[model samples]
Target: MTDCGCDKAKAELVEYLHNELARDDASDIREHMAGCADCSSEFHVNVVMTETVQRACRETAPEELRVQVLARLRDLQASHG
Candidate 1:
C-alpha cells in the first residue's frame, strides 16, 4: 500500500473535485490515483459526470427557473431557521 491509502484518498475525492483540498491532501490523492486503477476509474467517472453536468447547466439553465429556485431555497431556509 502507498503512504496514502485508497480509502483516505477516495474519502477526500469530493474535496479534490471541488478544488477545496489542501496541497498535501491533493498530492496524496494524486499519488494514490496514479497507482490504483479502480480508484482512478471511479475518480475519472466522477470527474466526467461533474463536468458534464456543470457544462450542461452552464449552457442550458433557465434564468427564471434559477431565480425561482433560489427564492424557494431562501424561503425554505428562513422557515427552517
Candidate 2:
C-alpha cells in the first residue's frame, strides 16, 4: 500500500476514528500515524474529545425537564393540528 502523507491522514482522521474508512485507507492512516508524531497527537486528542462528547450525550435530562418538554410539544402539536 502507498504511504498516505500527513495531509491525507489528518483529513481522514475523523473517518478513521469513526470506522467509516475502507480497510486500505484506514491502514494507510494507521501506518502514517505510526511514524508521524503530530498526526498521532492529533488523533489522540480527537479520540479523547470524541469519547468525552459521547459520554456527555449519554446523560439523561432531568425528569422534570423531560416532562415539561414533552408537555410543551404535545400542546404545540394539538394547537397546530
Candidate 3:
C-alpha cells in the first residue's frame, strides 16, 4: 500500500526495518519515522513478521529437506539439459 521511498518514492516499511541506512540517512529516516505514525507502525509489524518467520524456519526446516530439495533440483536440471 505504501511505498517506502525507494524507486517508486515509497515502499513497504519492511525496507527500513532492517535499519540498513548509512549514518546520515538512518538519522533522517529515524527523524521522519518519529513523525509518521503509519510508517512507525509498519516498521514494528515488519520486525515482528521477520522474527516470526525466522523462528518458524528454525523450527520446521530440517537438514534432510534441504538435501532432498537439492537432489531434486540436480535431477531436474540434468533432465532438462
* Best lDDT among the predictions, by candidate number: 2
TM-score list, all predictions = 0.66, 0.75, 0.55
lDDT of 3 by residue, 9-63 (tens): 1363454567665556565566666767766776677779999988988886579
Cα lDDT tens digits, model 2, 1-81, are: 788999999999999999999999999999999999999999999999999999999999999999999999999999999
Q: What TM-score quantifies how close candidate 3 is to the native fold?
A: 0.55
Cα lDDT over the full model 1: 0.87
| Model 1 clash tally, residue pairs | 0
| Model 3 CA deviation exceeding 4 Å by range | 1-12, 61-81
Please give the range of 10 consecutive residues that has the lowest summed lDDT in model 3: 1-10
| Models, CA RMSD each | 6.0, 2.6, 6.2
Model 2 TM-score on a 0 to 1 scale:
0.75
lDDT of 1 by residue, 11-71 (tens): 8888888989988888888888988998898899889999998898888568999999999
